[model samples]
Target: MPYDGFKDVKQIVKGDLEQYIIYQNEEVELKKFDNFVNLNDVLNEMEIHLKAYNRVASIQFYGITQDPETHSYMMVLEYEQMRIFEKI
Candidate 1:
């Protein structure tokens, strides 16, 4: 992901994502993703990509507050975007 020209880029923040489990009989797969942007536009763009690619299995966002009590702009976004490769 690119964050060039993102003026409000203050302190660096990290993101965390939950696990995604996919199972079929005796087959299973897991996927995870994290969002590392503080801007709303970037995050929205990601949502668009997820929908377009059909990779949006599940999503979650944490730690978004504008109160002065918080010390950091930390947040965590979790998503499941899976890709499959098979022979036609």
Candidate 2:
């Protein structure tokens, strides 16, 4: 389900979600995703997690891939267009 960057993002945030459910750099399948949880929670959490390591002025959410079984996701977030993956 492709979400409109503007309207959909906000809807997802308002939904019941858990940011801690997000995953990174893990060996998992992306072909499938968990329909049970709102991915927005993961996105929100990912952004929060990123801020912990680096100083992020702003984040332009791009894309994501979720592992169906574990219900966790892995994504590459550049350090605010610095072309850096992440500090940690």
Model 1 clashes, total count: 0
> How far does residue 45 in candidate 1 sit from its true spot (Å)?
1.0
CA error at residue 29 for candidate 2, angstroms:
14
Q: Model 2 Cα displacement at 37 (Å)?
A: 1.8
Error of 1 at 80 (Å): 8.6
TM-scores of the candidates in the order shown: 0.23, 0.33
Clashes of each: 0, 0
Model 1: per-residue Cα lDDT over 43-64, one tens digit each: 4655564464444344343323
The deviation in Å at residue 19 for candidate 2 is 18
Candidate 2 stretches with Cα past 4 Å from truth are 1-36, 56-63, 77-88
The numbered model that scores best in lDDT is 2
> Residue-wise lDDT of candidate 2 within 1-88, one digit each (tens)?
1211112111112222222221242211111223437777666766665575356444444457554447656443332342232222
Whose TM-score is greatest here? 2
lDDT of 1 at 22: 21
Ten contiguous residues with the weakest lDDT in model 2: 3-12
